[model samples]
Target: MKYDWILFDADETLFHFDALKGMQLMFERKGVNFTEQDFHQYQQVNKPLWVDYQNGNITAEELKHIRFIGWAEKLGTTTAELNTAFLEAMADICTLLPGAKELMDALNGKAKLGIITNGFTELQAIRLERTGMTHYFDQVVISEEVGVAKPDAGIFLHAMERMGNPSKERVLMVGDNPHSDILGGLNFGIETCWLNVHQHERPEGINAHYEVQSLHELRSILLA
Candidate 1:
């Protein structure tokens, strides 16, 4: 293996995070018909909160609370209740991305695998368990628990410490987001691979050591 450890970002990188479908399932469970317009409205609040959370302007708890404020009001419930419900729905619908399992299987014995996610702890555990991917990882780090979101070096440092402080050059951080995953890993002095599954433009000044559109490509590179 080229690297001793392969760190991954959860959500879009390994798991298919279909927020719209998750929200729809959540509302359905609550006896509400969630429409596309409703999801659009929800994103208007949710997206910026995530940005703020990643930027350290807001906390994970605050982001969770604020994003569901409108929905909570409509549902006559507390933000905590709605947030929990949404996470539950998301967990129920969670599945690994195509080729994700194969990639993990191929690398299981060859490299140490771990997950460092900005995703909430509640959904993270259940999703891993449900998808049967829990045992494949050596470590699972959540920003909510660590008190630092990605794009900040602190979280990467925390992950490294937990990883037994391996040589940074022998670690590869694989994730979908350039700003958070790639930049964060690069800034932390580790090699990075940007998993641009949707073909998004790479942001300026945040180059990755490798870029691939699919986990299959990553597997080929790693097992080459």
Candidate 2:
């Protein structure tokens, strides 16, 4: 590998984070049939909270509790319980994205690996463990633990610090989100690769050092 350190974003970049499906599974366990309509309603509240969360306008705990307020009230359950259940449901359905394992296996020992994620702390460890990916990473930086989310320079600094403060040019950040992962890494002075699996157009202001449609493509490029 060209870079001494390779950092990844946890959610869609490495794992499948199907929130709607996870919500449905969560509601199924609670005996509430969660429809697409309910998910849409959920997103109306959830999406803006994520924006606020990403902008650091709200804390992780606040984001966790606020988004489920209506559903908690409707179910007569605590938001804490609802949130924990949701995380559990999400964990139950978690799987590595295609080429994820292949990339990891190939990249092992080629460069130090780490994860910088905006995902909740509760899910990160468990999912890594369950996916048998725990041994592959040297550092796992959670925005929930760092008190700042991506698109903010603070979280990246924390990650780089944990990475033993490598040369900025010797690092590469890979993620699916153009704004958070690509832009954040750029601001932090590291190279970035966007995993544009959906083939969306890159945002006007954001530019990554590399863009690949699949992890296999990334692996081929890295090992070429």
Candidate 3:
């Protein structure tokens, strides 16, 4: 079947976190003063909190404040200080995944392209704009912006609606997370592609219509 739109996940799919890590280390060298342990703890606390937010157990403001507060407590820093430092550091970092620009350029007018991400809208926007990848998307749907996260059919439907409600069979959702993007697409009755760059095994009960190791594979899949 020919697809009319291709929706992508941002964090791991289009933007690589390795770039963020490098920037974080640069911040550490500049005396922002976070140790490896501190960073790991921060991530440990942050990830689950976002999952809770995605699952509708917490509000966006609450998630943001609480994530920083939790990190501050673990690192013995004040919430205000952590907030300032975190956002500054994140904005300074956050680079796009390798070949992201080329792949997007290749698909520019081939079909409709959109972004459906479970990230903070402001930060995601900053990252995309900084990487020069924002203009490639016809629609950018962030969970924070819509007040609904992935794995819920609502976010996917919202993106589809933004794309003018194309037939479900003719929409492709590609993302790195199995539980969020893959499962969410399945729930929305759209074809889903699992971007498994890390060589991870597909999670149980989350079947993707296609699996690709990199964005380059996308062109072939869409044209196939």
Candidate 4:
């Protein structure tokens, strides 16, 4: 079926976020004297904060501060220092996934494209703009901005509304996360595409309309 609008997820879908590795390297380079265990612990603290933020239980600012505060409490560091380091490291390593630009270019003008991500609006926008992907999207609906994350259906609804409410059958949702992107799109009655970057098994009972192992595969599918 032909789709009029294509919605994409950002982090794992469009960009490769080596969050743990990057944080470890950045701390070492900055003389923070943190161990890999510390980085892992920090990530453990940060992930749930993002989930909470996506669930609308916390503001973006609260999530940001909480991550650093939790890490600092664990590592005996100041929150201010941890926050600065985390932000700097995140900004430095936020690179696009391979073939992301090409796929976006390939889809350009062929179908309306937009971003529906469960991330901080400011950070998500900065990542897209910095990676030269800002212009490719017709709209970017961040969960933080919308007060709801994917799998909840509200976020997808927000994206659909922004896309002029294209027929559900003629809309495609693409992302890496099965829980968020795939399940969310299915819940919204839109076709879902799983960008399975890691070759993850398709979860039982939650099938994607399309499956791509890479961005190049996405381009090929669009061309087909």
| Highest lDDT scorer | 2
Candidate 1 residues lying further than 4 Å off, grouped into runs, are none
| lDDT ranking from best candidate downward | 2, 1, 4, 3
Alpha carbon deviation, residue 185, candidate 4 (Å): 0.6
Off by over 4 Å in 2: none
Model 2 clash count equals 0
lDDT of 2 at 7: 95
lDDT (10s digit) by residue, model 4, range 1-224: 27788888988898777777667766777666777787777778888887776566887667767777765776687776776666567767899889989988888888889988876554676777678888999999987678777777888878888888878888888999998889888988888899987787778998998998998988888778
- Per-model root-mean-square deviation over C-alphas: 0.7, 0.6, 2.6, 2.6
Model 3 superposed RMSD (Cα): 2.6
- Sort the predicted structures by TM-score, highest score first: 2, 1, 3, 4
TM-score of each: 0.98, 0.99, 0.88, 0.87
Off by over 4 Å in 4: 25-30, 50-62, 73-85
Better of 1 and 4 by lDDT: 1
Task: For residues 55-174, write the lDDT of model 1, one tens digit per residue.
Answer: 999999899899988878887899999889989999998888889999999998999999999999989989999999999999999999999999899999998999999999899999
Reference-based lDDT, residue 171, model 1: 95
